[model samples]
Target: MSRKIERLINLTIALLATKRYLTKSEIFRSVEGYEGSAETKERMFERDKDDLRSLGIEIEVGSFDPLFNDEAGYRIKQEKYQLDLGAITSTEVSLLSLAAQAWQGASFDEAAQKALLKLNSMGVPSDSLSLPTAAHKIDDGGGDLPLITKAIAEQQLITFTYVDSQLDRHQRKVVPVGLSSRSGFWYLSGVDQDVQEIRTFRIDRIEGEITSTKGPKDFEPPQGFDPARVFDGSSSQSFAIIDVRKGKGTSLRALATSAQSLGEWDQLKLPIYNLNTLASLVLWHGIDVYVQEPLELRGLIVAQLETLVSNHG
Candidate 1:
């Protein structure tokens, strides 16, 4: 592109931004970095004006100009410029502010805060509200979310320090595959280089910067592979299920959605398992959960409950 053309585009954009019409002389004064004779500049402006018109700018020649007597200039109509705020209601703003505060301590995008602020600036009435400043408190100490996000987007392998629920820390080199959220917890699904197996690690448990290894993220998830099934503590060797009811049913539904083979539970005959996953499901679901199948599982639940009662006893 010619320098003249570039400058013309920039000047046109600037003139349109002021929400007012500008004469040729005014536009020339406002536009910088253009050095040419008056006749040459005039010729260039005329060509640029035609170019702008060709580009659908609607550059009016004889537009209203208070400074000149019946002078012509260019103006972008107000209707042409739009920043749709979605007709925000006061109640919606309050609700959005509350929702943003709730994400204060969690992993979130910076754009989220900016978008919230922009919404508030547009008559959202968010100035009186104080959201949790905990969001800003998070530094680049734990996880480099931007790097991880880029790696995930580029389908690149990432190496990072991952700590399990058991508090066991290890350096994990994994092929970054996918990201998901469950029960308000963020999870990163990837293939462990050490184990050659796909696994899901909680994002919060990751306590170090993730480095992109530039390794090919070309591995495919195994056929019939299911992430939710991995969390269920069910493997090719053994598997189990339990009837989860009430909110537990919702959990099971989420699991089923993520991993289709978990199937459904018989609410009347709730299935239970001796597996850690079934136990976790029970514990997570709390006292209202019941063991439906497998007498062994029932015994395991009873044993755990007895231990709990004895601990409190």
Candidate 2:
């Protein structure tokens, strides 16, 4: 790892290690030997804080007294912290198991196994620990499981071939960042080299070797790249607020009835990243949801509706 990233990780580990929050000055004093002067130490502190944020660490800093005006300190929220694996969901247990079973020879296997054991010790029902049908049936085609898992384990890059729903094939190289499960599918979030953008691809669609490649020494993800947004099917490419309504709260016809109906009700604002996905969902679950912002999404939804109607008619 680069010196900056290494120091940042050390700083995060140090912050997470302590119970009481520490002020920036305290942190700088603690890390005085990290090769910097007082001014450089302050800059390093800011950089380390930004790095932590980039890695999705929610560190809060604030002062208790306005009159006294003591230096602000930082602390991780204990409620969201996970020091044990056993408390995680059974589905998560199964996914971990699949990962373990698929790539046992990887460098992180022992650690992962220990984590799995910790989870198994937890109260997840025995039956629920079994891998789901989708996961169990996924053939690896005798591919290099160790290499793939190592890539994920070491936070490296991996390239693979995937077959889309249309039966078309494409080769994609991605810097694997995270993995997640939603709606009964496993998805890998990564930065696509070809597109030069972050994207989520269904693991089941993956058709070839998960080749391990050296990660870019300094590549970093852009801010606000939430992997879940891709599967949620509603995210904005840029910062843009849009409104939404739940199906249960209001009828679609009622919502569209009059200016009063639309104005008087509360709305759910969202940043749509994939408008096409949102359009498809609206078509699939008609009258159950409403898109209230970014008129473009509304237009896309209308177009999708017309396409569906024409095809069906």
Q: Can you write out model 1's per-residue Cα lDDT over 230-286, one digit (the tens) per residue?
A: 555354443344555444456555443222223343343222333666666766777
The TM-score leader among the candidates is 1
TM-score between candidate 2 and the true structure: 0.42
Instruction: Flag regions of model 2 displaced more than 4 Å.
Output: 1-147, 164-167, 213-266, 288-292
How do all models score by TM-score? 0.43, 0.42
What does candidate 1 score on TM?
A: 0.43
Q: Candidate 2 on 49-124: residue-level lDDT in tens?
A: 7877876688878665658878888877655554454456757767767666653654455666786676676667
lDDT of 2 at 237: 48
- Candidate 1: residue 68 Cα off by (Å): 58
